[model samples]
Target: MRSKPFLTVAHRLAILAYIVVALFPLFWLLKVSVTPNDLLYSEGVRMWPSRATFEHYTFVIAHSAFPTFFKNSLIVAGSTAVAVTILASLAGYALSRFRFRAKYWIVALMLVTQMFPLVMLVAPIFKMLSPLGLTNSLTGLVIVYTAFNVPFATFLMQSFFDGIPRDLEEAAMIDGATQFVAFRQIILPLTLPGIAATLGFVFTAAWSELLFALMLISGNDAATFPVGLLTFVSKFSVDFGQMMAAGILALIPACLFFLLIQRYLVQGLTAGAVKG
Candidate 1:
């Protein structure tokens, strides 16, 4: 009995330590963002600054082009997540339910795509998109993001589908429902957690993407928030306070998105545990 109690305390302490390690950077970002410019360097190594101000946040919102960048990121990430989830759901259902000659090859091809470094394909992708007038457009970003995210999303959804029993769909079909109807009505509802997980994954990936956005987009008009953050750095000096403020702002959407889907994520985990 004493050993069991000690083990429980150790487990809790381990989890608390991990949480603090994971969140320390974000806490620092918040700390620096609020720190006044004069005190930034002077108060070095302090957990909190002597004085704090919202000027940095105000400047980022009003003086910078962050609003346009925010809008562009929202559009691109939202579109990519929706597109990837829809396509992945269909593909995942097929993979989970059917056995086809080409299925092995198809999965192999997707795995192979993931093997290559993205930097190697950047040139070829740029050449292909340039001719189609997609070089500096949000549509181009959405298309690329969707393509990159769908394969992984499909695999994720497939795992969730595999966890579900085939008997449910079979029962629905016995009641004169078509496979599509069974999938749409019965299977899908059970996979809410998986779907929410996929959406959050793709959205977070698309939102933080910087390399492709920087390479494909040329000007401020089409730039996403990741690229827009670079505007704070000039040849002479970098604006640490404003940059940190923008970083905090960039975190808001992702945090809210996860918060919105957190219940489903938890439900999915609980359901999986029960099923297992």
Candidate 2:
């Protein structure tokens, strides 16, 4: 049944309100990033100041170490995303398709791993990494982030694989394709949406991670953007302008990443793989 026009308008208004509420912080971030420093405090709660400037953007890019942080963050997040998605895709396919001994126990163990608070494990992790020379290194952060993100990504991919039918692979195998070939040629293609989603999810998680990056990285050289944001805080005052500018700049990679993947991110990758 078609809804009444008044009800449709009310529903749209409600949704618009929620969107505004959700995006208000981002709007504010953009606003502050452009607001002139002189007007920053003097404006005292105005949405749009009388004038705006790109001074913060210029300063952050040209004068600050934000570029280094950006590059480091890109490396860490990209590595983590790629590594986690690869491991998760393979593991998820196995979990979804193959039957094996102790499967339940293995999944249970993975679930148990996810249950522990990360902070509780930080000390142990630090001690473990220190002796291995993994501490204070970008590789160490990638390892840690990959480890943390894999279980969740595995589950995410498993859901997608589960939605796909086994018949396609079975038919491919019957037609003389090897299991690996069938998986690569047939199943993987249908899983693009899931892969894109997993990549985006893992990338964002590693990008914004602060606690582990802070504790593990001692120098600015290896610091991710989130950890580097702390540099804006001096003993005297916080440079909100440069910090917000950096934050805005930091969003570029993730936004670009999503833009690249969004075509594949459309849901229902398995739509035509199986009969409805």
Candidate 3:
């Protein structure tokens, strides 16, 4: 019992340290966002401001085109998340269960796709899309983001599917269900954690992605939040306050998304689905 107390204290301290390290940047972002511009330079390195204001947030929301960029980002990220998760779930389950011809070659091909730097493909992708009127379009951005994100998402989901047992589906099929029904009814419920994790991963990736969004989208109408943040910079000066405020606001959806799905992420729904 005495040893248990010591272990509990140690565990709590470790968690506290990790929380502080993880949340420090976010705390600083909030601190700086509220600090007045005049004090920004004058304060130098204070941990907290002498005073705080909501002026930066007001300016970003009212005076800037951040709202439009935010809306576009939400649309792009949301669509990409759904598309990637759906494709990855199907592909992952197939990879986990099916033994078919050229499986090694197929996996190797997917790995090969991930090995190349995206920059190398930008020129080729742009040239390809230009002929099809895809450049400067939201649909193009969605399609591109979905494609880039799917390989990684598929690998993530495949790991989860691999964790689940095959017995559940086999039992479901023996009970007069088709393969698809067994998958949809029995196996899928057990993969909720994997689905939640995959959705969170893909959504955050697409939400913060800047390179492809910047390159493919030429106009404000289709600009993602990351690209829109660049507009806060001018030749003469950068609006640190507005940019930080927008940056802070940009985090809300991701935070909410994780919060919403976190329940599934925690419950090990597959725990009893298989034998030890």
- Best-performing candidate as measured by lDDT: 1
- Cα RMSD to native, each candidate? 2.2, 1.1, 2.0
User: Over 4 Å off in model 2, which ranges?
Assistant: none
Please write out the lDDT profile of model 3 over residues 104-147, one tens digit for every residue. Answer: 89889889989999999898999989989999887898899888
Give the deviation of candidate 2 from the true structure as CA RMSD: 1.1
Better of 2 and 3 by TM-score: 2
Q: Worst ten-residue run, lDDT, model 2?
A: 267-276
lDDT by residue (1-276, candidate 2, tens digit) is 988999999999999999999999998999999998889999799888799899999999999889999999999999999999999999999999999998899899889989998999899999999999999999999999999999889999999888878899999999999998999999999999999999999999999999999999999898899999999999999999889999999989999999999999986667566566
Poorest 10 consecutive residues of model 1 by lDDT? 267-276
TM-score of each: 0.95, 0.97, 0.93
lDDT of 1 by residue, 102-156 (tens): 9999999988888888899889999999999998999999999998998999999
Alpha-carbon shift of residue 45 in model 2 (angstroms): 0.6
Cα deviation at 89, candidate 2, in Å, is: 0.8
